[model samples]
Target chain A: MWHDRAMSTTGRRVGRPRAERRPDSGLSAREELLAAAAELFTVQGYAATSTRAVAERSGMRQASMYHYFGGKEDLLAVLLEGTVRPSLDLARGLLAAEGSAEARLWQLCRSDVVLLCGGPHNLGALYLLPEVRTERFAGFARMRRELKEAYGRLLADAACCTALDAGEVAVRTDLVFGLIEGVILIHRSDPDRPVEAFAAATADAALRVAGAREEDLAEVRARAAKLAQG
Target chain B: MWHDRAMSTTGRRVGRPRAERRPDSGLSAREELLAAAAELFTVQGYAATSTRAVAERSGMRQASMYHYFGGKEDLLAVLLEGTVRPSLDLARGLLAAEGSAEARLWQLCRSDVVLLCGGPHNLGALYLLPEVRTERFAGFARMRRELKEAYGRLLADAACCTALDAGEVAVRTDLVFGLIEGVILIHRSDPDRPVEAFAAATADAALRVAGAREEDLAEVRARAAKLAQG
Candidate 1:
């Protein structure tokens, strides 16, 4: 009976062959949709972008778009999730890893700067959109808070390793995030700079903002190398 | 002949008495309009705010509002001018003043941080609105560039004194601005922090980002005191 049922299912199935399944651009349908949405949302403000426009840009029928996202807000939620979640995971991993707080913080900053500079458009810039501040995008805000808290913890740890006080640690954490986010604005104004150089400079600035002592820097750099190796 | 004409006009024309001319709030209609527009634009946004809404908020009819400003864009331009022009003037003043680059840079950062933190809504945050990036605000962009260039020069001078290379100086200048703008973001997240403390911390972080030496900070602080006296 089981064999008969399995045989019947094989005969009735009408799936596209594996060779024809992938799109010419090689992005999955969901990824293509996200890529299209990110482009439109970045170039044109999210309020002006429509589901139909996203579908058209993705080379899919408007009807098929619904299969991927519930609506426009969902599309944005997904796009932000794609950008924020990985960083959050990495931050959590770094926080747990064995290394000096300075090294861990440096690694986080370097990786984050790379991510901010990696994309064609800095997706982190989307956080500045007024629409993202509304209740509809509360999920994005929550994830952002988690990322910020991660920064706060790393900063506090770094402060402990250094001689910085609690009050200053709180302030420095915010400034460090700002310094990282500032790279996006700089990139927007002058996109010609090499990303690697920008990332390295931003990472070094972040350490400096945390009040890293000159003597500890050599040790931090050594630890940073080991952290990178992992 | 001029005195005779003025006397005749004063005697014949029914001008409101000086006391009657000024409003109970002691603001002219134009000033009242600007104050109202800043509040509305900061709470809502530029595109979402309407001229009629601004007029209503200002306790004037739409027609009367038009007498002060041509339209909503003009209202925003005036508000931005009020914010940006003063900072630009201060930057120019600092650039012209005689002092070590560190002292001049410190003073600019301290004063700018105060301005960014002084407002009820951190008005500098308005610069991040996507609508503000459009052609209508090219004047603001130009002023911002002048401000950034001032920062670049000061940083380069500091780097020269510190023995940092040209590439490092370029990187630090962008990070310094980022550190300052980060104050606005920090204020938004935790509005309870004392503005004085935030300003102090930001100025210190900025100097650190520029690679200020421990031995030189005391001299910079002394010059900052002298600069503040004026």
Candidate 2:
């Protein structure tokens, strides 16, 4: 579910054996904590979840959880960061690549949609939590801003976008970005809906919103398909 | 903030007077309770908010709250419905109105963006709360689906949409509806955004996603302007 699970992949911690068995999900101790927090926060409301509950869900003692995360917020910060950082990485690569910015933009949107919709829990929806808006989560907020900026950059460089004024480009970027994150609500309504199709349709809509030409739409799809491969 | 405030506007509940003075916001007692619940749920996490807290916020005793709502879930149910029902009503009217379906669709999307962004609390975001997914809120979910169908009908009738198959029309409608609800995240990041401008650009992008021809966009906007007046 965690297609974006990245961070501190280290050797397992040899903690004192506990009665509760943690499922061998192949995630490291820190990743296990993040996974547990993601599940608990989304399934049960965040405010109702305690750090103790998170630790228990991850099969660790409350004291032992501090070894990985400072508390619940830290776990949230990492998960939020995890979601954006992968998309940001892909965006940077796409921006540096030589293909038409149109194709790369489509590819970027497609991949970002997959990431947002990929996870078991709708972790992307967590961005709306009032807690995530606080100063404590500023880093996650900044990374998200950077990710949006990457969208803007790819979108701005697309030949179709050249005709747009600065304000228009910014507005289009906002809408395009909104459409990508917006899928969380759509996917929730039909959880069984295939992520691949959902991601593709959203990415296509994003390109359309960014002013991709109808005549060139197939070319954009072809080039994007190529980029996805290599 | 309450541009969509409707429901049981049946006069003030003449309960035993409470000690605290209620603000003269020109809203009915039931409206006051709904407003208080909306503010508390969005500002504080929903699970953390107590009906007592909502009652106190509205300057009423906890005992008096039951006169309006059964409990916290009821308050949430009303708030969620309030967010969608107005838009659904507008969509239904737009569906029945005589005019280009394109213009009506644009108008519906624009008006919805305004409603979602106009509120002081991001009540639309409350739709993402897992608790709302429970059977208790199925009524609210049905209202939202009805609204989406409104979008689909107008979209399916749009001249530009005639070329596509049913699946394509459904996908475009999904993206268009997604773009409208998706604005909550964008507006949250820039709360200062002018809803009118934001709404217009979004409606335009929605039309674009719905396969409205470029040649017809200006016409759609012009007709939508007239519809806005009459």
Q: Give DockQ per model, in order.
A: 0.39, 0.70
Interface root mean square deviation per prediction: 2.2, 1.0
Give Cα-based local distance difference scores for all models: 0.74, 0.85
Tell me how many clashing residue pairs each candidate has.
Answer: 0, 0
**True-vs-predicted CA distance for residue A155, candidate 2, Å:** 1.7
Candidate 1 falls in which docking quality class?
acceptable
Q: Give the TM-score of candidate 2.
A: 0.90
Alpha-carbon DockQ of candidate 1:
0.39
Report iRMS (Å) of candidate 1.
Answer: 2.2
Q: What is the C-alpha lDDT profile of model 1 across B1-230, one tens digit per residue?
A: 22232233447522221221245778776777778888777667656678999888877677666556779878776676566676678889988888688888988888878877786665665665566668888897888788888888888777433677777677788889877866766666677778887786688779988887555666787888788897
Which runs in model 2 stand beyond 4 Å of their true positions?
A: A1-23, B1-23
Q: How many backbone clashes does candidate 1 have?
A: 0
